[model samples]
Target: MGEATHGLIDGARHAFVSPGVHWLALLLLCSAYLQGAFDKLRDFGGAVAEMRRFGLAPAAPWAVAVIGLELAASGLILSGWHRWLGALMLAAFTVAANFMAGRFWTAPKAQRGPMTNTFFEHWGLAGGFMLVAWHDLGGHLGV
Candidate 1:
């Protein structure tokens, strides 16, 4: 590569290896869960409605469970204590939720496309969590 291109690549490599990068990436991964938890807390009625729409019985209880899990798991991850366990918890949650909510095959034809995309995106998030778990187990948890 040209000298400037090589320097750019080197900088990026260094940047990615920094603790800041790890912290930022972990925050990004947990951002959705944190936001969801906050929003549910702010509008518990809406959360209950969402649970009901998803056919979960005792919608209020389900909403509370979801909020608690999201907050607890994401906190474990961000705090870097039992990070692997937190990561696995979120991974399992992501898979279960994808199955429960991303049933694209049953969706209307017009909506199936978006639903399918969401399904795969959730799977990707699960995979990211798995990788985070692996990284933590290896004792290289930068966070």
Candidate 2:
């Protein structure tokens, strides 16, 4: 490759694999869920009602558990301690929650589009969590 091309590639590689970049990526990945957790905390009663709307019996307990998991995942990921475990936890939770709440296939025709979109969005977030876990486990893109 040309010298200029080689320099560009090296710079890109450094930028991509830097610790700052990793942290920023994790922050972006976790931002939505963190907001969700905060929202649940801010509106405990509303969260319980929403959980009941989702058909989770014992809605109050389920709301507490969900908020707890979200907070735990955020702490583990932000602290970079056992981040892989946190990522896995979030990924599993995302999948279960998506299926539980985003039942697009069974929804009425009018709601299918939005519900399906949400379901896929959650899956994408799950994939992002898995990628974060892989990186934490020492996988890299030749950086």
Candidate 3:
């Protein structure tokens, strides 16, 4: 590689392997859910409406459940208490929500690009959660 490219790669490697990087990464991963939880709490009515738009009936209850799960997952993962369980919860939630809300294949052609991007983005987040679970499990139960 060129000298500049090599330097950039080395810098990235350094950052990736830094001490406490795992903790930082986990925190960053949990940030989105944390923020969402706060937003739902702050604007509960809006959240319920959004859930209703997604065809989730009993919008109020579903909204509450979603916020509760987000909070629980954030707490567990951030506290490192049963982190694997938290990761799994978040991962499963992400997968389900992505498929439910991101239906790119069913969207109009003009909207497919953004919808597909969002769908894949959610999956990427799910993969991050899985990685967190695997790391936290430390090969326990074969992860």
Could you tell me every candidate's TM-score relative to the true structure?
0.89, 0.90, 0.83
> Which clashing pairs does model 1 show?
none
Query: RMSD for each model, in Å, please?
Result: 3.1, 1.7, 4.4
Please report, as a residue range, the 10-residue window in candidate 3 with the lowest summed lDDT: 134-143
Best by TM-score: 2
lDDT of all the models against the reference?
Answer: 0.95, 0.92, 0.93
lDDT of candidate 3 at residue 13, scale 0 to 100 = 89
- Candidate 3 lDDT score at position 14: 91
Q: Which stretches of candidate 2 lie over 4 Å from their true place?
A: 140-143
Q: Write the per-residue lDDT of candidate 2 for residues 1-143, one digit (tens) a residue.
A: 99999999999998798888878888888888889999999999999999999999899999999999998997899899999999999999999999888999999999999999999999999999998899889999993
The candidate scoring highest on lDDT is 1
Candidate 1 local accuracy as lDDT?
Answer: 0.95
How many residue pairs of model 3 clash at the backbone?
0
Q: What is the Cα-based lDDT of residue 29 in candidate 1? A: 100
